[model samples]
Target: MAPAATAILRETFGFDDFRAGQAEIIEAVSRGENVLAIMPTGGGKSLCYQIPALMGEGLAVVISPLIALMRDQVCALREAGVEAGALTSANSPEETDAVLDAIGAGRLKLLYMAPERLASAAALSLLRRADVRLIAVDEAHCVSEWGHDFRPDYLRIGDLRRALDVPLAAFTATADEQTREEIVARLFQGHAPRIFLRGFDRPNIHLAFAVKNSPRRQILAFAEARRERAGIVYCATRAKTEALARALQEAGHAACHYHGGMEPDARRLVEERFAREDGLIVVATVAFGMGIDKPDIRWVAHADLSKSIESYYQEIGRAGRDGAPAETLTLFGPEDIRLRRAQIDEGLAPPERRAMDHGRLNALLGLAEAQECRRITLLGFFGESAAPCGNCDLCDAPPQLFDATTAVRKALSAALRTGERFGAGHLIDVLTGNATERLRGLGHDALPTFGVGREFSRSEWQGLFRQMMGHDLLRPDPSRHGALRMTEAARPILKGEAAITLRRDTIASIERRPVVRALVRDEDQPLFSALRAKRRALAEAASVPAYVIFPDRTLIEMAENRPADMDAMARISGVGAKKLERYGAAFLEVIAGEVAPLHPARRRLAGGEAGPIYDRLMEAQAELARGPGGTGKPLSCSHAQLARVARLGAADADMLERLLGERRAERFGAAFLEILRAGD
Candidate 1:
C-alpha cells in the first residue's frame, strides 16, 4: 500500500534512478531500522533519509550541527515542493510559530534542529507533541570525541533518540574506523545499525599537490586560469585568511575572507555572498566549509597544508558537488609539515593517539610524495583500492625521477653530524657549506658532513629535505622545537644498503603550470559570460545567492546547448520546474542575443534601485566632462571611480570631492552630489 521509493525519487527529486547504495539505505530506513550511512561527500546522502521521510507516516526530525546548513536544506526542500522547516536561534518568532503550527497540524513532513537544541527541556516537550517518528543525524561523526569536529552538544543526540523511541539514521563523509565505532556505541547504544559503507572515491574531482614556491603567486595563477567560477581557498591561520583575501582582491578577483574570529554577522554575510555570487573566492581558515551545501564550487585550493588527511578530504570535498568536473590544488612545504607535527605532538591526546595522528600525517605526506598515482594512494589510505586515475597531476605528467640514494644519505649524515637538534634551515646551511655564526658556535666547521653537499644549490638541498620529510625518513622533533630527526625508514639508506629514487623535476624547479583544464571551449566562452551576467542580475534582484538563481554547472549547460525555448531549458539538469518557471525566459533571451552584456563595473550595480542611479550618475558625469562653464579641457572619472561614489551614496559635495579628489571633484562633485540626493 506504500508508495515505492523509485516513484518518489522521480516525481519529487526529478532523478531517473537512485545512486549506488541510496535505494538500499532508503529501504532499510523506511523499514524502521537504525541506519549508519558512510557516503562520500556529494554522493546524494540527503536522499537516503528525505525520500524515506516522505514515504513514512510522521515528521522526520533531522539533527544538524550548523544553522546555515539547516536553513539551506529547508529552503531547497521547500523549493522542491516538500514541507520542511528548521528551528534555530536564527529563526524569527513568526517562523518558529509557523513551524510549531505545522507540526501540531501534521502538515510538515520534515523538521530540522541543531543538536544543541535537544539539551533544552522546552524543546523536548514541544517535540513530544509533534508526532515525530524518525531522527536523522547529519555530520554524525561530530558526536565522536576522536572526530575532527567534535561537538559537546552532539552527546545529547542518543538520549533524545531513546526518549523519543524513534528510528535514527546517521550520516557523515569523513569517518575512520575509530570514529565509526564511537558513533555506533554512542548513538545506537552498542546495538549495531545497518551500516552502508559507500566507497570514498570522487572520480569527478581532479587532484593535485604542489610544494609551496611563491605561494601567493601560485594561488593567484590558479585563480586566474578559472576566472569567474566559485571557489574556496583554505588557509591554516586566521591572519593568513585575511592577508590572502586582500592579496586576491587587489589582483581583481571578487574575493573575501572568513574565520571564526570574525563577528557572527560578518561571517554570515560572507557565507551568503559565497552562496549567491559567481566567480567569488573565499579565502578562509578551517573554520569555514563544514556543512556548506553549495554544489557549483568549481575548485578548492589550499594556500597552506591541511592538518590531517581527514581534514584535507573534507575541505576539498566542498567543490563540484553537482557531479561536474571540479579541480583541487594543495600546496605544502617543509614549514607546513613541521607545523603539523608540532601541533600533533603538543596536543593533550594520549601517547597512542599522538602516534596515530603522526601515522595519519605520514599517510598524507606519502600521497604528496607518491611516485605512481596520487588518487590510488589517497584511496588506499581510507581502506579502498583504486586504479591509477588519469585525473590527477601525477598521472597526467609523470614526474621525472632519478637515483637520489646518495643525496638522501648525505642529507641524513648532515642531520646526524649536527646532533639532529637543528631545523632544516641550519641543516641546509651546513650542507651548502654556508658558514654562519651559529654553525661556527656549534663547532660544525669540524664536522665530517659539513660542506659535503655543496654540489647541489641551497634551493636544491631544501627540496631534498622536503622529499625526505615526505618519505617519512625525516620528521621534525617537537620536543626540541622542530629539530630534524631520522626515523627508522632512513636507517637502511644511511647504511648504503637501500637505493632510493626521488622526483628530479621537483628538485630542479617548482612547476608553475595550471592544474585545472578549461571546462568549456574557447568558442563558447562568450556565451558563458553572457549566462553569468544574467544569473548575477537575477540573483541581485531576488536578494539571494547567485547559485540560488542557477549554479555554474547549469549556466555552463545553458551556454553549451544554447537552449532555444522553455521546453529545451527544462531538460537541463538543474532546471527544475521552479527554476525553469522563474528564470527560463530571461536566460533564453540572453542566449538569443535579446540582451546586451553589461560592463563588469555596471554589472555590480545592476538589478536594483542602484542600476538607475548608476545610469543617472554616468549621465551627470558625461554632462560635466568639459566643466560647468564649458571652457576647460575634458576631464572625467573612470567607471570604477563613479561606481564607488554611487554605491556609497556620497551625500554632499565635500564627500564626493573627497572620493574623486580636488581636481576632478571641482568639475563634477556638485553634479554627482545632486544625482545621489535625487535617488535618496
Candidate 2:
C-alpha cells in the first residue's frame, strides 16, 4: 500500500486495516488506472475514491445519482475536516456561490455533482475551470441501459471523461455480467477498467422467503417481532406503500412511506429522517434506498417481489450493514409474478431487453422457491458458488419436497388441450373438473386432461403453477391477456421424458422470532442512548444528519468501550485525526461525563498543504493593507482571495491585479506573490 494511502486511512479515516479489496483498489486508483470495482453494498466503495482524492493532485470530481447522498457525504467529509463541496440543484444560491468560490480558490479537493448536472454547458465550464484530475462514478451500474436503474444522463459521462482526459474509477453494488459489459461499453467506451469483482455475498444478512398468505398480516407480524428496530418494507406500487405504511402506523409502529411520486421536499424529509432517526420503519417503493449510507438498519422486508434477482439482492443488502446480524423476509405470490411480468412486457424497452428482464425475473422466482440455501442461489446468480448457509428460512425449516413431475405434466397437458387461450386460473379450473357453464359451453369438460389434477387442491395447483412459471416452463403471454403459454422446456416434462421436483407451499401460522438488539449489548444500551442523544444534538446544531456527525457504529463502539480521553478516543475505529481533533473532546466528555474552538478562514484549509500558506498570506495582506508607505486608503482582500493567492504556484502583478482588482492588488500584490514564492 502507498504510504500516503496508509496515512490517510489511519489518521484521516481512522482505520488501521483496509477491507478485503480496498488496499488493492486504492493502490490502482493511486496509480491513475481506470478502475471498475463491483463491490457489495456497505463494502466501503466511497473510501476507494476518497483516499485517492486526498492523495492525488487537482480536484476529484465524483458523479453521483442522488442529491441526498451527495449532501450526506459532503457533510461527513467536512466533518472529517476534508475540503469537499457539492454543486447540486438542492443548493441555495448562496451555497452554490460558496462552492464556486471554493473551486476558484483551489480550496476544494473533492467536488460532487449529480450526473444530470453534467448536461448543462455551465456545469461543464465549471468542471473545466476546476481542473479535475480524476473522475469517480458512484453507482456505476446506472450507466448501463440493461440495468434496473439506468440513467440517460449517465451516458454522457464518457464524453465528459474524454474531454477531461482523466482516469475514471466507477463503483457500484449491483451489476451482473450483462450489466457489467454494458457499463464498460457505455462509460469506458471500449477501454476496460482494472475490474474488481469483490464477491456479492453479504454473509451478515439472514435471508428468508415466504409465500404470501395475507401479506399484510405477514408483514405486520414480522414487524411486530422486530419492533423498535429500523427496517424497510418495500412495496411494488406507490399506493401499496402508502396503504402499508398507514397499516404499520395503525399497529403502533413509527412508520412512513416513500415513493418517487412524492414531492421532492417530502422525499428529502424522509431521507433525512431515515438518516437521523433510529428504529423508524420506512415503507417504500423501489424508488427509495439508493445511495443510503446509514449503517445501523437492522432488517429489510419485501411486501412484494422485486423486479429481478439483482434488485432483490440490492434491496436486502441494505440491511446488516454494520456486519451485525440483520434479517430479511420477502413475501411473494402469484400476483407479484404476474405484475412483474406485465411491467416488463409493457415497458418501452426493446424486445431483447424485455426478454432479458423476464429471464432475470425467472431467476428471482427460482430463488423465491429455492430448495437449498438462499445465499447459494443468490450468489450463484452472480456466478459464485457456496455451501448451504444455515441462515436462510429453508435452512431453518426445510420445506416438504415432493415429486412434482406428474402434476407438472398434467398441468401442461391441460394447457395444450385447452389451446393455450386461457390463464392459469381458467386452466386450473378446467383441470380440477370445475364444470362451469362456460367450460360446458366450450365442451372442455370432455377433454382427457380435464379432472386429471383433481387430486391436488386448487391452492396447491396454484402454487404448482407459480413454480412452473419460476422454472420458465410456462410464460404469461401479454398479447393474449396473460394466457398460459408453454415454453420448450415444458415439452419434455409433458412427454414424460423429464421429471421435476417442487417445494410444497404451505400456509402456516407466523412463528414469532426473538427480538434482537440493534447493535450494542444490553449493558451498553443506556450509554448508547446517551451517546446517540449527544450525536443528535451535535448534528442538529450543525444542521446535518446524525450519521454525518458520527455514524451509529462509531457511537456504538464508544458506548461499549467508553474511551475516557482524547488519546484513547483517537484509537477508536472512526476517530480519524481530524474528527478526533474536531469532535473527540466533546464526545470524550460524554464518555467520561466531563470538551479548535479553527477560525472559519483557516478551518477550510485543514487537510490540504495550503493551511500554513493561507495563514502567511493573511498576515501579508494585513501588513500591506494600507500600502508599503502606510499612506494609501485602507484595503483588504476576502478570505477566498487570500486562499487563491496562497494556493498559486507562479504569480505576477497583472494576474494579482485581475484577481484582487486595481487598487487592492497595487497595494498587496507584491507582498502576496513574494510570500507564495517563498512558500514554494
Candidate 3:
C-alpha cells in the first residue's frame, strides 16, 4: 500500500511540521484534486508537489520553464532518493538514454520537462505510455499572455492536460487577480481549482530605497559592506553590468558580469561557478534570476529601479531563501522614472495595457518615495495588510515629510505654460529661474509662470518632479520625445481642489551599515563550514551543484543540533530517508543531525454512475457540435454543461434541451437522453 501523507512527509522530507497553509493544499492535492497555489517564493512551494509525487503510485510530470531549474530540482530529488529525471534540449545522448530507461522500468517517480516539449507528438505518446497521473506546472503564471513572464509555449499546457485527462496542479509566486483569472481561463478552462493564496510576507528580507546620488558609488559601498558574500547586483543596461563588475573587481572582490548578450557557453560557465563556488558575485540584468535555485543569497541590490513592483518583489525574493535575514537596496532618480515611463509609452501594447503598465510603475514609485513602512507599501500592492515591520529603512530611520502641494502646483504650471512639450530637464530650468538658451529660443522668459519660483535649487526641483511622477500627477509622452505631460489625476492639485505631500530627499545624509549578518552563531560556525566542505566534495564528485546535496539551511541545522546517530540525523528538517541511508554515517562523524481523468472537467464527477454517463454525453455533444449533417455553423456544450447533464437523476427532452440549449437538443436530444436514462 502507498504510504500516508504524513508518513511520506516525515520519512521522505524530514520535516516534522508544515508551513502555514501547506497542509491544507497538500491534502487537497493528495485527493486527486486540481490545485492552484500562490505562495511566496521561499515559502517551500516545491515540497507541496514533491510530497504528493512521493505518496502517489504513478509518475508525476512537472512542466518547468528552464533547464537549469529542472536540473537543480532533479538532482535534489535524487539526493533524497526519490528517483527523478528531466528531459530537456540540453540533455546529452547518454543522459537521455538513462532517463528513458528509468521511465520504461517504472523506476522514476517524477519527470521534469519544458513546456515546449508538449507540442511534440513523440512527447505526448511517451507520456501516454508512462502512465502519467498528475501534471504540475511550475511558474504557472507564464501561461498568461498579460503577465511580464508570459511564454508562448505555456499556452499549450491546457491542450496537453486535456489529452492526458489528468488532474493538474499549477503553482506560481507572482500572479495578481488579473493574472489569476487569465490562468484559470487558459489552463483550467474557466474551471476554478482549489486555490490557496497564502500570505505574501517574507519578513526575513529587509527593504530599503535611496535616491540615486553617485549610484555607482552607492552600489559599490553596499557591496563592500557585505564582502565575501554571495549576492546579485541588477542593472538596467548591458553596459552597466560590465562596468559595475569591473568596478567591483578593481575593489579586490571576485565579481563577474552576465547578460543575454553573452555566449551560451559563457553563461553556462557563470552558472556553474555560481553554483559551485561560494562568495562569488554576479552582476547581471533581469535575465539572470528566474532559474537560480541558490538558497543562500546574502543580498540583492538594484543598481537601477525595477520596471514594476511585481518585478521588484520577484527579483529581491532570490535572496535569503533559507529563511535567513537578507537585505535589499534600490536606487532611483528622476531619470530612472523617465526612462521607465518612456519604455512603457513607447511599447507596442494596446492603450489599456499601456495604462496598466503605467499604473504598475506608479505603484513601484510609490514604494520608493514612501513615507511609512516599506513592507506595508510593498505588501499592500498584493492585496494584503500588516502592521509595521520594524526591519525596513523607514522603520529603521523614518523619513522627514513636508507638504509639497504648492511645489507640485508650480511644476504643473511650468509644464502647462511651456505647452507640455518639454522634458523634466527643461522644466527644471524654467522653474529654477535659469534662462537657458533653449528656454529663450522658445520665447518663454516672459510667461506668467516663468521665474516665479527660484527658492528651490535645480536638484531640489528635480527631486520634486520625481515625487510628482510618483504620485502619478504627470506622465512622459513618448511621441514628443519623453515630454512631461500632466495627467487627469493632477487637475485637482493644479486647481487647488486637492493636496499632496512628499518625503524630503535626504540622499546625502544616509549612512551605510553591515546588512549581511552571520548566518549561524560563532560557536557553530566551524561545524557549519565543515558540513559545507563535505557537501562541496560530494557535489563535485557527482558533477552537480553543491546545493543539490544539501542546502545551507540544512547544514546550519546540522551544526546547531549535532546529531550523533542515524535516527537522530533523520529527525533534522531536510534529512529524508534516502539521505539518511546514503550519507548519515559521514555526517555523524561531523556531528550532524537533523534532520485527473475524464475530460479533466467531467472526470471530476468520478466514482459514481455519472462517470460513464458523462462520457456518453460528451460523445453526443461532439456529434452535435456541428449540427445534424455536420455542415451548419459550429455549436457545442461546455464541459460543465455535460457534467450537469450526466448528474441528472431523470431527464426528458425538454430538460436536456434546457441544459444543452435548443440547437444542441434539436440535434442530439434523443441520443443524450438514452445515455442519461441508461445510467439512471
RMSD of each: 18.0, 10.8, 18.9
Report the C-alpha lDDT of model 2 over 518-613, residue by residue, as the tens digit: 577889988888888888788778888776777767887888888865546767788787776677768877778653234554554544456678
lDDT (10s digit) by residue, model 3, range 1-680: 13477767766666767887788887788788999999998888888888888787888999998787898888888877689999999899999999999999998899999999988999999999997888999999998887768889999988888889999999998888889999988889888998999999999899988888889999899989888778999999999999999999999889999999999888877877887677789999987887577888889999999999999999999998878778899988877888899888778899999889888999999999899999999999999998999989898877888888898899999999999999888888888778888788888887777876688877778778888887788888778887989999999999999999887745224544435567789999899889888887888888877776777888888888887655456667777666666666677777733321124454244334576687778777787778778898887778888878888968999898888788778877888888877776
- Name the better of 2 and 3 by lDDT: 2
* lDDT (Cα) of model 3: 0.84
* Better structure of 1 and 3 per lDDT: 1
lDDT of 1 at 138: 94
Cα lDDT of model 1 by residue, 1-680, tens digit? 13578756654554555778888899899999999999999889898999999998989999998888888788777766789999999999999999999999999999999988988999999888888999999999999896678999998888988999999999999888889999999999988999999988998899998889899999999998888778999999999999999999999999999999999999988987887777889999988998998988999999988888888899999999877789999999998899898899889999999989988888888888889888899999999999899999998888889899999998999899888999889988888888899999999877888898889998888888999998889999988888999999999999999999998788878584646666678899889888888888876886666766676777878889887655466566566554554566689898874644455566544433566677788888778788877777999888888778878754777777778899998888777777888878
lDDT of each: 0.85, 0.85, 0.84
Per-candidate TM-scores read 0.84, 0.83, 0.83
CA deviation > 4 Å runs, candidate 3: 1-3, 507-514, 562-568, 585-680
